[model samples]
Target: MYYNILRGGINLKKENITFLDVLTLFIGCFLMSLSLNMFFNPHSVAPGGITGFAIIVNSMTGIPLWVINLTLNIPLFILAYKILSKKDCVKTILGIIFLTLTLKYTIGLSEIHVTDDVLLASISGSILMGVGLGFIFRINGTTGGTDLLGLILNRFFPSLSVPILMGSADCIVVILSGIVTKEIEIGLYSAISLYIIVKISDIIIEGFNNSKSFTIISDKYKEISSSILEELDRGATILKGEGVYTGNKKNVLLVIVSRRQVVTLKKLVKEIDPNCFIIITSINEALGNGFKSIE
Candidate 1:
């Protein structure tokens, strides 16, 4: 059971999981372990996950992080197995095993600190966590922590997005870890690290090709539209709009452009019609000719 690909935001069918996927999962697990053993664990900073909880437990009970991580994930994997596809289950279990093994082998790395400052440690560790988990999520592979828990809970609560659920779950762990360890700054730093991790992972998954959409209202719609088409080599849509207050007929020009072209577009519009009303808004994603293709 392997996820061939996702379509319309869901895994629709099964296909062979490629070797590249396996290699990517391994690398993701490795980086996560490195962040834990080399950065988070050394500073006693739990950055919010089952791994975070395990770190706190290790600090308190003198237990190996690997044991705690594996123990906590097994039940989660079992719960996730019932709802998820076989492919997801396989990859998730592999993620758990790889992480546990890496945690065991890389425990010695804790003796080496990349930074003595807690703030620096938190930043560096969070960066690795983000990149690692980003790779894992890009492949749609789960490591059976709150990641799995979020998926399972999504069945019960369909309105909330998985990321929100995962973040909420991790937040609870962060708070509890702070309470148990009696360290307020640990929680504060962990919260910061968690934010960076979420941001970086989102960047990796959604990509950096962010775009903007513009709605332009002006008397010189024709000139603005032409300039946009000729100067930007992009398409524009002409829309008929009536101003409610004035009830006057007006032409609205709609344009979409990449982030890099935002300044150029502003200049183009300003030069053409300084009095033109322009509404610019951020676009999370745009598909079709000038952007990402529908999969």
Candidate 2:
């Protein structure tokens, strides 16, 4: 998916965007606005980023959220235009315009809510916003806000992760919301909403088939490899390695499997060679012949 986006970006200078791209952008922004008006804003739960900032401003000054959102994003748009690619800037502008419009028109949507459960509202609202964000990101567009600021800051500080920087910025807003409202639970709920948004956005962008990667070192490498291929119906790759402690050559096995299969694979490996060294880690995405298709 990323490779295709990069390829499309190269040709994006021609400014030829498909109807589907525009449709996706509009849908994403609309959902974001709906979630804000109906769930987050009504409940005073700030989910962080530009949206959170807008929520805070609205709460304090009695201004409409759409107005605050647009007012704050204008400078960010200028910054994006200067720092990001033209294609990116165009998409961001489209997102901002549609998002603000949706927020303006959907002002009364929150009044019709049936549930007052803050937990339910926070989680559901976060999911909606996250999916909206995922769509924008999938199309190589960003909703102009702290996300764009994080990108620009990354240029000056190459070693810092953008998500961390953005997360920290968001926490500050959440904390301020607590201080201003004098309700500690609101801040705690906001933090929960923020976490849900990040997680859901990752799942949308990375795909839903969560998997784990395992690296194994053992004397019975061949048997373990065969068991994984034949018994578990999973592929295994043998990597050549040199053990520095004993100066011995060894074969390391690498395998990928679903989260549920981790226990079964671990048992199989232990049965084959109890002394085997194993390392397991979760992977966000895996695309190829055995897993998801690239397309």
Off by over 4 Å in 1: 1-16, 152-165, 284-287, 292-295
Which ranges in model 2 have alpha carbons more than 4 Å from their true place?
Answer: 1-17, 151-165, 267-271
How well is each residue in 28-100 modelled by candidate 1, as lDDT tens digits? Answer: 9999999999888887888888999998899889899999999999888777777887677668777898999
* Inter-residue clash pairs, candidate 2: none
What C-alpha lDDT does candidate 1 achieve relative to the native structure?
0.86
Instruction: TM-score each candidate.
Output: 0.86, 0.84
Query: Candidate 2 deviates by what RMSD?
Result: 4.6
- Cα deviation in Å at residue 119, candidate 1? 0.9
Residue 194 CA displacement from its true place in model 2, Å: 1.2
- TM-score result, candidate 1: 0.86
Model 1: pairs clashing at backbone N, Cα or C within 3 Å? none
